[model samples]
Target chain A: MRWEGRAWVFGDNVDTDQIIPGRYLRRVSYDELGRYAMTGADPEFPEKVREGDILVAGRNFGCGSSREQAVMALQQAGIACVVAESFARIFYRNALNRGLPTVEAREDPTEIVEDGERVVVDLDELVLRSESGEVPLREPPEFARRAWREGGLLELARRNPERPPWR
Target chain B: MATVVERFLSEKCGERVEAGDVAVVEPDVIMLHDGSGATALRTLRELGTERVKRPDRVVLIFDHSVPPSSVEAANRQNELLAFARRHGIERVHVDEGVCHQILVERGYARPGRVIFGGDSHTPTAGGVAALGFGFGGTDMAFTLLYGELWLRVPRTIRVHVTGDLGPGVTAKDLALTIVGELGAGYADYAVLEYTGLPERLPVGDRMCLCNLATEAGAKSAYVPPAEGPERLRPGDADETVELDASEVEPVVSVPDAVDRVRPVGDVQGEEITRVFVGSCTNGRYRDIRAFTEALDALGGPDPNVRIVVVPASRRVLLRLARDGTLERLIELGASVAPPGCGPCLGEHLGVLGDDDVCVSTANRNFPGRMGSVEADIYLASPLTAAVAAARGELADPREELPRTALERVSGS
Candidate 1:
């Protein structure tokens, strides 16, 4: 799978609370949640973000809280993929479980990719291309790759009704 | 040569496994609280599973929005209760306490058991030698449906501590120091196994250390097996770090970043509007008793500050009441809330107003955590929070606590 979009850059330790605050957690619907995505970090983010944009961030992206709503909010806001220097483990797992592609760039994407610059993410080749340069990405594990290919764990589970994929 | 977590997971899975290996295993207990239970139930329905595979292993607790902070919250909790009733899941707690505290108090998180909860602080179970961690809603739903989940066996980081904490310094201070040194992401995808802890350290203090490992990005934290059939010692780990407790000083996590810690003297005299002494991090009975004893020695809280105290569990509250600590706190101008999470998540009960500054004993000081985004929060020990309440500003507890009072509070 591949994605091409404009880049939205964030700094290190952009925690789950910054992605979506607890006040908006009462509403589970993605559309309602999308309107407030990243508002904690920048109030104008929701209004300025366009559909199919890619997020470039520094180390430890999604660092706080285990709320999956953070992932859902980003997806609802039309973010095509997230490329970071590193990711908090739970958020990385949640994003993959929900079929949202995440790449851990070999170099810090925030240092190379400028906001609003055009970028391309090629999961098959594990590379990210931006105007400045091309950055290598770590390949996800086989199970995670399969989850992304199947459009998430839910879809994969549906395809195999008798038992879960891991089982 | 297996670490504590590896041994626990291997036993549960009935196979030998090590770091980086993926295995499907069943947990002895599955915990869901108000914050995540509703979402998990909805996902279960969407997955077309009506009956949970092991209702007997599930424990549901409503502590996030106890007494229903809003109509929407009320409806959601009601839905969870109804679902629990239908599934015949008998272990349900409402308005009892924080889910992690209740899990330990009820003995559900036994030594060497694998436990799963819906909140990130589920690692608190490791205080008792259990391997516990958080799962997302959909993952939890899937586990409920199939009674098992796959996990990558995490590498372990062993933290060895020696010596004793100095006067007026508590476990919270030590936790903050470790987190500050490790940085927020140093332990990502790893388990922290604490060894060489003071032999007489209280369970509450152990829980405090384990609880804050999440801030360092650890999947879970563990100490050596305290009791049970298994008597295990610290074994092979990916890395090791050492901490000398005697050299530690009272510290605080400055506003908005938990890993941004500094000595109490650096931020002393910063005026605060409120003081909160509760949460899963430091709401145990001993924490409250320390606060109460310090406050009594200081005469009382300042008239200009608002102080709120909440116990970690119903049992804690009952103990405080029976021991007369609750009455003394109320007499000293504290507004005690129920035995649940109060304003820690900014949900209800003591949410801060715009521009408010608070000294809190709870973990996490992210923006908007306890209230308005404009508000500032400093994470400190209960003793430090009590001193801040007395002075209406940050002050070193060491200077304020008389030596006799300090000795009594520290149980020296």
Candidate 2:
């Protein structure tokens, strides 16, 4: 799978609260949640975001809260993919579980990718291309890649129904 | 040698596993709270799963939005209740306590067991030597349908705690100091195995230590079994951090960053508008009692400040009531909220307003955590929080409370 979009850059430790505050958690619908995505970090984020935008961030992209809404909010906001220097464990898992592509760039993408610059993410080749240069991305595990291909674990679960793939 | 987590996961999987290996295992307990349950139920419906595989293993607690802070929250909770009824899941708790506290208090989290909850603070079960951690709603839904989940076994980091805590210094201070030293995300995808804690340390303090491990990006945290052969060897961990409890001063995490810690003296005299002492982090009975005792010694909170105290659970509240701690706190001008996560996540009951400065004992202090983004939150121990309440500003607990009072509160 591949994605091509404009880059939206953020600094380190962008916690789940910053992605979507706890107050907005009462709203369960993903579409409604999209309106508040990244509003905690920047109030104008929802309005500034366009469909098929790629987020470029520094280390520890999703630091706090195990709320899957953080991942859902970004996906619902039309973020095609997230490329970060690193990611918190739960958020990384949630992203894949929700069929959202997350790439851990070998180098800090925030240092190379400018805000609003066009970027391309090639999951098959594990490489991220921006105007500055190409940044290599760590290869995700086979299971994770499969989950992304299957459009999340829900579809995988539906296919099996009787047992999980691991079992 | 296998680390404690490796051993625990091995037991669950009925096969030997190590760090970096993926294992499919069944958890002894699956916890869901109001915050994550509705989403999981929705995903379960989407999956077209009609029945939960192991309804008996599921535990549902309503604590995050207890009493339903708004119409939307109420509607979501109602949906959860209806789903629970339809599934025939029997272990359901409402407005009882935070899910983490209730899990341990009810004995669902035990030594050598594997537990999974929908909240990050689920590592609070590590206090009992259980291997517990958080999962997302979609993953939780899949687990509910299949009765098992796959996990990558995590490497272990040993936090070697030693020495005795000084007067007025509590576990919360030590937790902050550790997080400050290690930085957030230091333990990402790893298990923090806390060793060398004094056996006499109360279970509540142990819980506090494990609760904040989430801030450091730990997948889980564990304390060695009190009386068992499943001990962690010296070199079992990938890394080790030495921390002397006596050297830990009363510290606070400044606004917007859980790891941005400073000594209380460094930020002393900063005026505060609110003081909160509660949540899964420090809402245990001992914390409330310690706060009340310190506040009593200081002659009650300042008139200009609003002090809100929340118990971690109904049982903790009942204990305080039986010991007169609850009455004394009310007499001292504290408004006691129900036994749940009050204002910790900024949903209801003491949400801070713009420009509000609060000293809270909850876990996270990120922007808009307890209210307005402009509000500044200082995360500290109950003792320091009590002092801030009394002075209406950040103050050193050791300077305010008598040594005897401090010792008594610290259980030193």
Model 1 RMSD in Å is 1.6
Docking class of 2: medium
In Å, residue B241's CA in model 1 sits off its true spot by 0.4
Best by lDDT: 2
**Compared with the true structure, what per-residue lDDT tens digits does model 1 show for residues B319-403?**
9999999999999999999999888888778998887999999988888887688889999998899889989889899998898
Minimum summed lDDT over a 10-residue window in model 1 chain B is located at B225-234
Check candidate 2 and list the clashing pairs.
Answer: none
Model 2 chain B: lowest-lDDT 10 consecutive positions: B226-235
Per-residue lDDT of candidate 2, residues B1-412 (tens digit): 7888888889888999999999887999989999888878877777777669999999999999987898888998898888889999999999999999999999999877889888889998988878798988887887788888889999999999898788888889988898899899899999987878634467888888899999999999987755665353333888999988889899999988999999999998999999999999999998899899989988988988999999999999999999899999989989999999999998889999998999999999998888788889999999999999999999899998988779886633
Candidate 2 DockQ vs. native: 0.71
DockQ of each: 0.60, 0.71
Instruction: Please give, for residues A1-167, the per-residue lDDT of candidate 2 as tens digits.
Output: 88999999999999998899998898455558999999878889999899999999999999899899999899889998899999998899888878888889899888778888999999889899988788899987787788888887777777776777566
Candidate 2 global Cα RMSD: 1.6
Error of 1 at A85 (Å): 1.3
